[model samples]
Target chain A: MSVELISRDNGIVAVITGEIDHHAAAQIRTEIDFALERQTPSLLIFDMSGVTFMDSSGIGLILGRQRITESYGGAVAVKNPSPCARRIITLAGLSTLIIEGKKENKNEAR
Target chain B: MKHDNYFKITLPALSRNESFARAAVSAFAAQLDPTVDKIGDIKAAVSEAVTNCIVHAYADSPVVGVVEITAKIKDDTLYIKIRDKGCGIDDIKQAMTPLFTSKPEEERAGLGFAVMESCCDKLKVTSTPGKGTTVTLTVRLDKKELA
Candidate 1:
């Protein structure tokens, strides 16, 4: 699986493309973390539209990213998650932190 | 019951090894056309087992370890075993608890075991404190059980 980063002034968007199974977890984690740390955006959006596969490790990646973003008083959002990816995210009960939409929910950070 | 076509792969005990494990099992399970949900579950179980090996088993040590994965077709069922000879769990019960993670700093949801349990027909975990942990999962083929 491959991950691409698009940094914006408002937030840094991570476009994760490929199968996010156990194998891709570590590298994805490292790249995302580095991007988040370097950009330090108030919001981090993960675009999973291109993700064809995902598992529990993907859930961990979301949780880990959320924790890191929240630590800096920032928030994380997941946008356009594929059907399969959404199922796993919802199964993990992480919908509270990660949302689906175009406009950002600014209130969630508080 | 005598069966044929079994495969075993030993992956490096690293965080990146999960993909290999998942692919190996997915290839084996493809004959069943397991639903997307079932495939996801299988991958999840594999992830939990591998993650445990990477984060907890080999904790801080650079010593390379091995995660042995075995897949066998028996009696219309696919059994997958993931074994890691790293730091063994002291308390299986506590370790299996939902959201009970040894490392909170890593932002672990601690739902690995729960996810694995949800994904497979049967999930069994056997661990020796100093020896290692073995996670055995059985997924009954869809047709035979359905019929």
Candidate 2:
């Protein structure tokens, strides 16, 4: 998985690529947390346009980040999650946390 | 009735292998000519089952544990079984409960079984505390219309 942090005037946008599974959650959490710490942006946007698949572990990663951001008076938002990923996030009761961003038409085949 | 096709694989209960298991099962299910949504559902169910084995089943082991996955197609239904020989669950009911993870520190959402249940037609879990745990998932493939 690859996470690229872009500094915006409002907040930081993290563009994440690849699958978010148990194996990739730790690294993702660490990277995003580091970015959050350094940037300390009021908002953290996760761009999941390149993400192919995600499971419950992805929920844990997001919740963990949410805890960190909330502690510092910052908020988290998810952007452009694939249909499959969106379903998992919704099932975990986290769809409300997602801020609808760019919509992608990619089919989740994997 | 006997299965028309069957596949089995044994892998170490490691976090990295979770994706491999999911991919393997999804590839096998492709024979049913399912849609992308159906394939996604199968992958999601398999991922949850395998993740449970890696996280909960082998929670405290210095050595790597083994997880066995078996997929079979019978008629229009696909059957998947994931077995782990590590630390078995004490209470199957409690374990299957939504948001009932033993390791809260790990940030576990505890929605593994719930996701599996939602994605598949049937989910059956059987375990013995000292023995092992087996999760069987049954998914029905809808007949595709000819173009």
Candidate 3:
């Protein structure tokens, strides 16, 4: 997976792409966690627009980020996740933690 | 719905191993005409279970272990078995607790069993200390059973 970290005025935005399976989890986790710690933003938004497949590793990464951000009294949210990604997040009871944007005609394969 | 077809696969116990197993089972189960969501859930849950085995069960063991996965279709239900001959859980109750993990440094969410329970119709886990652990997962494939 590829992760792009954009530092906004208020928070850090992480744009993740590719599959979030076991192979991708290790590197993505380290990169995202490093960014979160270094930036220490009040809000962390995960742009999962490019994620095609996500298993439990993705869920763990989200929850871990939430825990880390919450320690700093910050908030975390996700934007524009694919249908399959949304379903997995919902099943993990993370819909409340992350705000999803309105669905668009993108990443329909997922 | 009355007959059962079975297949078994054994791979090295490693972190990236689960994805291959999930892909194999998903492709096999699709031949049974299960709903897309059902297939996805099964694939996800199976991946979590198998990954857990590779991560926790075989954490420090130098000796190689096998991760066994079996998929069978019987009576319109899909049965999946994942076995790992690694460090067996001493307390199954504590192991099943959500958010309880032995290794937080690994960022183990401890949601493996919870996800499996939420997705499959039935999930049974049997473990023997120092022996091994086996997880049996079953999901019905009825058209009306899926969202």
Candidate 4:
């Protein structure tokens, strides 16, 4: 899986595409973390509308990002998760972090 | 009696192989005519099992170990066995507990077995310390409905 960062409202929206397993988590984590360290946005949004598949590793990815972002007084939100992804996230007890998929202009990051 | 329809594959216990292993099994499971949702469940569980093999089982070892996956159809049940030759769990019960991960520092949510259990009809794990681990996941795909 790959993450494309979109800057909006003083935050970063990471649009993830492809299946996220333990294998793909490494690269995806690094890219997002790098953006966090550089931009240090006030919010981190995981737009999973393109995520066709994700397991526990995906949960871990989000949790880890939350931990990092929290230390910097930042926030995280998951947008438009697939049914399977929503089920696993809810099972992991992170459903509260999800946001409705609505009203976002696609502003590509620099 | 054992079902004659089955397939086995052996691959290096690498993280990248997780996707490959799950896809292979899903393809084989097509014979059961399972719904896309059921197939999604099977794929997620398979990914978790294979990840454990790569992360926990072969975590310390520099040598790339092997993961064996076998899928079989018996009656309406789909049986999947994911075996790994690595440092097996010392306590299977503890390992299966939700939010219990040996590699917590690595951000492992420790929900592998929990996810597997929720997705499958039956979840069984057997491990031998320093030997290996075999995770058996069974899903009932009401093939009768399709028939």
Local distance difference test values of all predictions, in order: 0.79, 0.87, 0.82, 0.89
Each candidate's DockQ: 0.48, 0.75, 0.52, 0.87
Model 2: CA > 4 A from native: A102-110, B1-3
Instruction: Show the colliding residue pairs in model 4.
Output: none
For the second chain, the TM-scores of the candidates in order are 0.90, 0.95, 0.93, 0.93
Better of 1 and 4 by TM-score: 4
Question: How well docked is model 1, in DockQ terms?
Answer: 0.48
TM-score of 2: 0.93
DockQ-based class of model 2: medium
Fold similarity of candidate 4's chain A to the true chain A, as a TM-score: 0.91
Model 3 residue pairs with clashes: none
iRMS of each prediction in angstroms?
A: 2.3, 0.8, 1.7, 0.7
lDDT of 4 by residue, A1-110 (tens): 77787887689998888988887888889999999999888899998878889899999999999999999899899998878888889999999999987634564344
Model 1 C-alpha lDDT per residue in residues B14-95, reported as the tens digit of each score: 7766677776797888777677667777776777787788778878557888899998877668899989888789999998
Cα DockQ of the candidate 2 complex: 0.75
Q: In model 1, what lDDT does residue A42 have? A: 93
Q: What residue runs in model 3 are displaced by over 4 Å at the alpha carbon?
A: A102-110, B1-3, B144-147
lDDT of 4 by residue, B1-147 (tens): 645589999999878788899999999999888998999999999999999999999998889999999998887788999998899899888888899999977778999999999999999999899999999999999754533
Clashing residue pairs in candidate 2 (N, C-alpha, C atoms within 3 angstroms): none
Per-residue lDDT of model 3, residues B1-147, tens digit only: 256788999999876676788889888888678877888888888887888788878877897688999999887788999998989999999988877788777777777788788889999999998878999999888865555
Error of 2 at A70 (Å): 0.7
TM-score of each: 0.84, 0.93, 0.86, 0.95
Q: Answer with 2 or 3, whichever has the higher TM-score.
A: 2
Better of 1 and 2 by lDDT: 2
Query: Which pairs clash in model 1?
Result: A23-B19
